[model samples]
Target: MAGFRYEEVAGSIAGQVEAGVYGPGDRLPGVRKLARQFGVSVSTVVAAQHLLEDRGVIEARPRSGYYVRLRPQRPPQAPERTRPEGQPTQVTGQALVLRVVQAANEPDTVQLGAAVPHAEFLPTHGLQRAFSGVPRRYPGRATDYLFPPGPVELRQQIARRMADAGCRLSPEEIVVTNGAQEALVLSLRAVAEPGDVVAIESPTFYGLLQAIEGQGMRALEIPTDPDEGISPEALALALEQWPVAAAMLMPNFGNPLGHRASEGRKREVVALLEERGVPLIEDDVYGDLAFEAPRPWAAKAYEDRGGVLYCGSFSKTLSPGLRVGWAAPGRFRDRLEYLKYAASAATPAFPGFAAADFLARGGYDRYLRRVRGEYARAVARVRRAVARYFPEGTRQTDPEGGFVLWVELPAEVDSLALYQAALAEGISIAPGPMFSPTQRFRNFLRLNCAQPWNGNFERALRRIGELARERSG
Candidate 1:
């Protein structure tokens, strides 16, 4: 207990750093002074300073005392309110989406395109160890097909994690799928028929659009606020005007925009949909990656009736290669299970077993705390870089969570051209049009903030900004 006193001292210093008491590049009190202030020994103050230095909150000079590191600067402004057409638009960005997604996966390229977290931030070694033990632990289970609903252990772990998002779910209510993509597909299939119009957030994830188009459904893009998420007013108006079959949304840390709906807004949307008798499918893959304390609530949390189908995945938080995802489809549970059965019969057993093992071992929460802090710092660094390098007219989203930034460039700068130019330079960017069904947001682009901040990433960002300036000129 005496040896751990430094942690308390370090936390107090961190609090000061966060509270702006010790601003960027400002000198902190000397070790003796801090020791006297905290009533701790000089050795304890030294340990606390080391901890802060390791966490990147402060730095030490060769001959001088410690000084605060420069915090990530704020960007100019968030993008204005989105204005998408009210009517349904046929989805046609599948080919472009596929191309950009493939490019994002290329090796040796700076990846600022895909919304996936960098491998450096994930628990790759732990997951691999878990996977290694699965075969020996469950001899024949690895080879045999897991039943439709998937392994009970994995489902139970997922249900426990769901509570963090304000949803209390039973393991039996969850259906395991290959990934959140499949869960979303199953959810969409369970509720909407072919050719039905589904309302979605404008500038949403391209994968959602591809899935909607693949299902032979139309998309009605709703006006979304950068900070508050999809407008309840716009959604209510769309429902009143159109024959909307189902509504899909990412309420917490939405991809591209990274907008999170408030609890009241989420409840209002749910009540509106419930009154209209429309099923709601929620993609919450990024919910667990919130940078703030006390994770935001999912839209499913406010579901008084049973119209919310909540889909989540371990890909973002853990290894994407695991391909483990689950859906808690309320009221339509039977239909969703049937669809999951028809699609693949069962998810891969080993990944489920491994994930279950990982979660049960009690390491996930610790890992989340580490990664959440890293991602928050990384996002701030990326925002500061954008502000320094991007054209003067550029505006970007100040997302509360997740690792992606939506940048709105001048209208004269076409994002597609910027994408191509950036790709040639070994940089990948998700062009804005890919996120919209009607090819809107041509002047915007989404950048992945998951990668650690370094000189290489900074160069890539500057190059993209140069390309944008050239095009605009």
Candidate 2:
């Protein structure tokens, strides 16, 4: 579509400016030249140029085509790593998390609450063709009811992908699941008992908290760094003091905070847990979504002797509806496989077959290259908007990748109250309580930056900031 092609061109040009390819006031190539470069019509280039002008990414002169705009003021400082000081407690606040998440799924509301990728970012046509071709390509896998460990086609593809994360695995070692949530749940069950204590990052994904709650387990909130991720020293102290049975982490571009652990820190985490004989469930759902290439390695990459259980999903990078995820549950593979069978018998093979086909035949790498840039530009734009519109003393995370921004409002602004107020105004935001089991981060807000940059989105974000200031009053 011309609309999408123009957006792509606009995003690409914006990214070039972000990468310093075009400095402020530097004139961009003429529309015709850009059209030739991007292989689009002259009209599409004009539309894209108009879009850049509208978004303030560039300015135009009477005869001079366009030039990058001068950069804006720096955003607020990032919130420091959290210091969660509390004993392991049974997860609470599920009702609130559920309520906000459910509300975010509504179609009419301004959707700044959910971090789901927009459909424009998905390979819609390619996936449809892949799905239709699945039956023709793999007739048996498409029709047959696959048992646990799923179809070899999907697992093999997953294994191949995992190689980028610095893990060497085979199809037999991976168990396909409904999604990362299910894979995380299976990993939890495979290792710990119902009443055992499980350690987690300070402000982690709410879904994992719910999973821990469902299993009747307690979550030990560890002190995590905004820049470095879960602290190895803090985790060591927690293990020494508590009877932590297993630990879960997000090594690459974690949710809310969007912290990416350095490989050394990752190795330290893996080693610390191994030293304590505690299993590490590495949730790497956002690993592949790193804005730049040479994708970060999973903690499973630095495994000493297979104590790390790596869980990943295509839901974030690929289609979430596909519900394709896998777990490399080292040392607990058999148990996880059996439990997976007992819980769901087998995941639908058709999705996996389609995903495999898409990876093999479709331009997944090309898609990643494009979508990564889109998300990076989107996140940067949202950050700048927050800086321009939000009240002073409001700090937020400047993540290198991932499409979620964690904002720390002024102390007087309670995010829960803000969430309610914003909902009344037909806007949805994920309050800080949704990401924690202990209801910490009373003044924090996690804003989804996955939506396209548009006038409506800008208005909605500005409105949210206005509501926050009103609440602060």
Which candidate should be chosen as best, given TM-score against the real structure? 1
Residue 152 in candidate 1, Cα distance off native in Å = 0.4
lDDT of each: 0.87, 0.86
Estimate TM-scores for all models: 0.87, 0.86
lDDT at position 6, candidate 2? 97
Model 2 / residue 92 / CA error / Å: 0.6
lDDT of 1 by residue, 1-473 (tens): 74689999999998886655665556899999999999999999999989888888888889998987644233558898799968998998668777776765788889998877889899988888889999998888888898778999899999999999889999999999999999999999999988999999987888788889989999999999988889999899999899999999999989889888899999999999999999999999989888757898889998888899999999899987789999999999999999999999888888999999999998788888778767776777677778878898899998777889999998899999899889889999999989998899999999998886678998999999889989887
Tell me model 2's lDDT, rounded to 2 decimals.
0.86
Q: In model 1, where is the ten-residue run with the lowest total lDDT?
A: 67-76
Query: What residue pairs clash in candidate 1, if any at all?
Result: none
Candidate 2: clashing pairs of residues: 81-226
lDDT for 429 (candidate 1): 93
Per-residue lDDT tens digits for candidate 2, residues 28-143, read 99888998999999999999999988888888878767877643123448898789875999888878877777765688788888778778778888889988898789967677
